[model samples]
Target: MDLELQTERLTLTPCTDETLLTYSTNGYKLGPHIGMYLEELKKDASALGWGVWLVIDKQTNNIIGDIGFKGKPDNEKSVEVGYGIISTKQNKGYATEALKCIIEWAFNSDSVNKITAECLVDNIPSVKVLQKLNMTKIKNDNHMLYWQLNK
Candidate 1:
């Protein structure tokens, strides 16, 4: 299988019908919600290179989480990102490394000028990941904070 990105400890695998089905059947530990999102991505042709990717732990070859764009870059050449790591896997720095790899992959495209993300204001860990990556806080609403990083 072709990998979308790789870091020192993780391999980011693109979501495809075959891969999702195999992971589901083999009990590879990808969380429940991810399947639904991958199914949705299968319905959109443009999502081929812009959907979620499975995060694989190199040493254990375990499915720890997923990370990827919400969709393809928008008209403004900005893309939004989302990710999740299983509860047991949180705070291990996997999310941060996976995000950095994905960001680099996104910026490799000539059309992508910026990456954006948002999280509930109380989600401190997620906010910290954005901050650690040097994404600037662009705005805040009653319950959410928005951030962006330009290439």
Candidate 2:
């Protein structure tokens, strides 16, 4: 949404091309993960008022990471929630905190029915983050683990 959402320490807003470019640079240091599709994130913001946003610390306002839903998934009416916390900020519970906000928003939106996500099976931290959100594991393929939050 054009609005801002807050967690105890983070804020979420719609992702834009400006933010996407910023995300690419910030995300690289966080993980080797391929990164978000700029065009797709724009599509989400335009069509749904929801897309990945720069995660800013409430106290520091530092762009520590990003978290939000993308518009592509095999499932209809479903969006995939994705996140990346800077490696420097990793293990501080930021990923889990960011994820909790995104997941709750998805479940509450009429535009989105189910929220799904995937992680490299070897990404132990990500797996735990999803579990903490109560997202159930639904499949594993090609070394990727898939989970869904259906409300």
Candidate 3:
């Protein structure tokens, strides 16, 4: 795993089972109700080859959040990037930094070409990140807006 991605103010690395559990349950305990989904993520990571990772601040080495692609790509068309920042770290631009790093890696990888992200239509903050990345809004299926990144 390429766990040592160094950004201007952040360091990125893959998450372990214990750390992932802590992140998810802690995130859930605070907000977004994410605890129910942590197990599924753990199971999938165990069975699949890739999983989310931590974005650490360089100055403090504190974990900001987890971000990465999960599951197999559909017919190898595109890989989905999933991410979440700790409550205290939100709105400070850390997610964008981590996301750009991961997306750059995905695009450079042999298995992926285009990239995709799904966010609730009402999730304004996430939508802004995609926009900042220059992802196009292709369509909305149910309540999820599908955003795409392709060159």
Candidate 4:
């Protein structure tokens, strides 16, 4: 199914081949990781919602960042969520808002029951965003902290 997760100020557009082509044809400079996402999509059409989703600002109609799952949920029905916003757009609650929308979208799927994430230990902003989502700190290594939320 074609999906566009929406929030108050953002639209999370899944990075399907068609969507990526449309964005590129429209002169949007995609991130390098988008190529990898495209390759995965080429291998499996089911990867549509499991890869990068462009975070678009509803007002300015510009891409503010990207956020989405790394892959489909595993055997345990758990998936990892990741996101990043442009420095200029950071700290405006866009990450939290966009993530909340996607989280709700994911929970609506029977394939997903748990969502997880990881951030560098020193990345206070990301930590705050995950905390704002009410995700619990599950574990941490020397450099990264892991978090989780159950549906």
Give the number of the best model, judged by lDDT.
4
* TM-score, one value per model: 0.86, 0.78, 0.76, 0.91
Q: What is the C-alpha lDDT of each candidate?
A: 0.82, 0.72, 0.71, 0.86
lDDT of 3 by residue, 1-151 (tens): 4546778888776655555543333332322323423555666654232455577777665666777776556685577788888878799998888889888876666677888889999999999999999999999989999998984
Weakest ten-residue segment in model 2 by summed lDDT: 26-35
Compare candidates 2 and 4 on lDDT and give the better one: 4
Two-way TM-score contest, 1 vs 4, winner: 4
For model 1, how does the per-residue alpha-carbon lDDT over 1-151 read when each residue is reduced to its tens digit? 2355779998888877666654532334655656766777767766766777888888777777888888889999999999888777899999999999988888887768999999999999999999999999999998999999999
Model 2 stretches with alpha carbons more than 4 Å out: 17-45, 72-75
Model 4 C-alpha lDDT per residue in residues 1-151, reported as the tens digit of each score: 5488778888789876666554432334567788889898888988888889988887777777889999999999999999988888889999999999899889988899999999999999999999999999999998999999999
- Give the root-mean-square deviation of each candidate in angstroms: 2.6, 3.7, 4.0, 2.1
Candidate numbers, best lDDT first, in rank order: 4, 1, 2, 3
Angstrom error of the Cα, residue 133, model 1: value is 0.4
TM-score, predicted candidate 1 vs. hidden true structure: 0.86
lDDT of 2 by residue, 89-142 (tens): 899999898888877776666666788899999999999999999999999999
Once model 3 is optimally superposed onto the true structure by TM-score, how far is the C-alpha of residue 119 displaced, in angstroms?
0.7
Pairs that clash in candidate 2: 1-49
Model 2 Cα shift for residue 116 (angstroms): 0.5
* Residue clash pairs of candidate 4: none
* Model 4 Cα shift for residue 64 (angstroms): 0.8
